[model samples]
Target: MGDHEVLASTGVSELSAPGRCSQGFGVPDLNAWFRVSVWSDQGGMEAIARIRESLTLSGEG
Candidate 1:
């Protein structure tokens, strides 16, 4: 399957909020990965930067 198709098949199986942190699950790129993270405005900005860096480094932005 294509990348978009692979991504589209993923779904959040569960969600949990613990204090200031939140986490969820899904198959990431057909790898069955569980994604988790803490919630914060500053963290969002940092994640943006990291994503940009990844795209630029991979020449996929």
Candidate 2:
């Protein structure tokens, strides 16, 4: 969020489960906040998509 802008927001929520999480989201369970943003239409979404694709390739979401 340093140089980028918030193009969309879905707020935040809490998660509680009795088992391990594959996304590693449970490790930093304290930071329940979640967000994603664009970089002023300067290939922002593309960069994000690339990152998402990479994560997907590595078994992440």
Candidate 3:
């Protein structure tokens, strides 16, 4: 918990769906997280990787 952190989760379901979550943290509580959902037949790690990349690019790791 070095000032800021990123949390993410990915899963599959009956259907494929793209989802994203964003949150702005306050000074006192610098925390951020996102979740992704996709079709059960699809790969979940890709979605999770995307989220991680986004966070890294945004410098919110």
Candidate 4:
């Protein structure tokens, strides 16, 4: 948390709103997380690198 944590999730763009949770697709099961080779290995680190590269290419993050 930061000094302004309470106001964190609010919309930065004027067109959006904070409280609008969508009727999204199917919820994932906890079991799916257990099956991934993430945090316990370099797979997690690689994921971050990939995301950074993607954001750099797309000009947003």
CA lDDT of every candidate: 0.35, 0.32, 0.41, 0.26
Among residues 3 or more apart in sequence or in different chains, the pairs in candidate 3 whose N, CA or C atoms overlap within 3 Å are: none
Between 1 and 3, whose lDDT is larger?
3
Best by lDDT: 3
When sorted by TM-score, best at the front, the candidate numbers are 3, 2, 1, 4
Flag the better candidate by lDDT, 2 or 4: 2
Q: Looking at candidate 1, what is the lDDT of residue 4?
A: 19
- TM per candidate: 0.28, 0.28, 0.31, 0.24
In model 3, where do residues sit more than 4 Å from their true spots? Answer: 1-3, 9-34, 56-61
Output the lDDT of residue 7, model 4: 13
Residue 48, candidate 2: Cα error in Å is 0.8
Across residues 1-61, which tens digit of lDDT does each residue of candidate 2 receive? Answer: 1222222233222135222121211113233334344443344445544544443111122
Clashes per candidate (backbone, < 3 Å) = 0, 0, 0, 0
Tell me, what's the RMSD of every candidate? 7.5, 15.2, 7.1, 17.9
lDDT for predicted candidate 1 compared with the true structure: 0.35
What are the per-residue Cα lDDT tens digits for candidate 4 across 7-58? 1121122225332221111113211111112242334535533433443111
- TM-score comparison, 1 vs 4, better candidate: 1
